[model samples]
Target: MNVKPPSNAIPTTATAHAFEFSQVTSSAGEAWIDKNLGASQVATSSTDPASYGDLYQWDRPADEHQKRRTATITTLAVNTTPSHADFITATGPEGPYDWTIPNIGDVDDALHSAFFARTDGSGVCPTGFNVLTECN
Candidate 1:
């Protein structure tokens, strides 16, 4: 399956290096995805001499360094149906009818190598084949 990351979903160097990861699972046959955006709290007491401690302590003022952006992943099955010669002839030849976002984990795994690289859809979808369509 080919997965396309939402437009404007890339993270910057500072965000990527300090980011925490989370998983989002969509219900079968449903459209639209939900994930919490922003920096996650790191434990204050867990730090040792080797570390500088959590970025935001529980008792301290909440960290206001992160912004939230919601993104949705859509999936579509490739069509195997054939088109009419008249339709093809009248209009320019077209490719597949539609596509769905690839599984999130698949995209995530593909990005492991470039964990710190600044990027947009390049790291995730890599393939430039997103299209507009309806989903349930």
Candidate 2:
């Protein structure tokens, strides 16, 4: 699945670097996040970049959480039901925010396996890209 970009794809002033692409089946692609995303690894050691690009939680935006050294505020305990109070002081929007409850089949469950593309125009991703949804 390696693709060489067209000559025009590279900017005239920039040097093109060799990029590698690996072919993966649908099932293997679905399992990638659990096995590699957010997992601890030596960034400078002899390693493959495909094994580690970045890690992200379910529906949360790609913030500092991806970096191992970055500190994150844990608002709720795992598997606990979150209340309005839990998110009252959150920096973002108002209460009744979306969150996934652990182990229960309910709306806003972060663990719910589905495709969730952000449409709110929050700019969660680059201009031409959309957030990658969790694969069930």
Candidate 3:
């Protein structure tokens, strides 16, 4: 499951082999990382904003194509504080992904504050959008 931020909150995503691409777009690449890999574990910068790429645990693989890239990280809980929260992966004139959104649920309550529609136009939840149930 992907961990999506609240509609009121900013959007964040998982990191990928950004530089590997012929031409890298800092914000676009990082947004993909935040949405897919989860938030970064280190400090963020323009080059590594939100530190999305660093979130994964890349290990050499037997396959050459995957060898250069590290393994994906899959051991994170849905408990990040607002101050240190790095979920907002993309912003401004850098990314194509939308961050401010809301998922569908018949029940409207404070707990459902974070749930949002997975995609911009799709009524259904996005394939990997993570649901945030509780906010402390």
> Among all windows of ten consecutive residues in candidate 1, which has the lowest summed lDDT?
83-92
**Alpha-carbon TM-score of each model against the true structure:** 0.19, 0.32, 0.18
lDDT of 1 by residue, 1-136 (tens): 1122344452221222233433233464222112212225322444432222222111111132111222212323222112211111111122242222234343333333343132342322222212122233
Which one wins by lDDT: 2 or 3? Answer: 2
lDDT to native, each model: 0.25, 0.32, 0.29
Superposed by TM-score, candidate 3 places the C-alpha of residue 82 at a distance from the truth, in angstroms, of 27
Number of clashes in model 3? 24
Candidate 1 yields a Cα-based lDDT of: 0.25
lDDT of 2 by residue, 52-134 (tens): 64444444444444444454454532332332223212232223332333334544554332212432333232222234542
Off by over 4 Å in 1: 1-17, 29-35, 41-136
Order the candidates by TM-score, highest first — what do you get? 2, 1, 3
Per-residue lDDT for 60-128 in model 3, tens only? 111222222433222232222122222333332323332222232222433333333333312112333
- Residue 79 deviation, candidate 1, in Å? 45
> Total clashes, candidate 2?
3
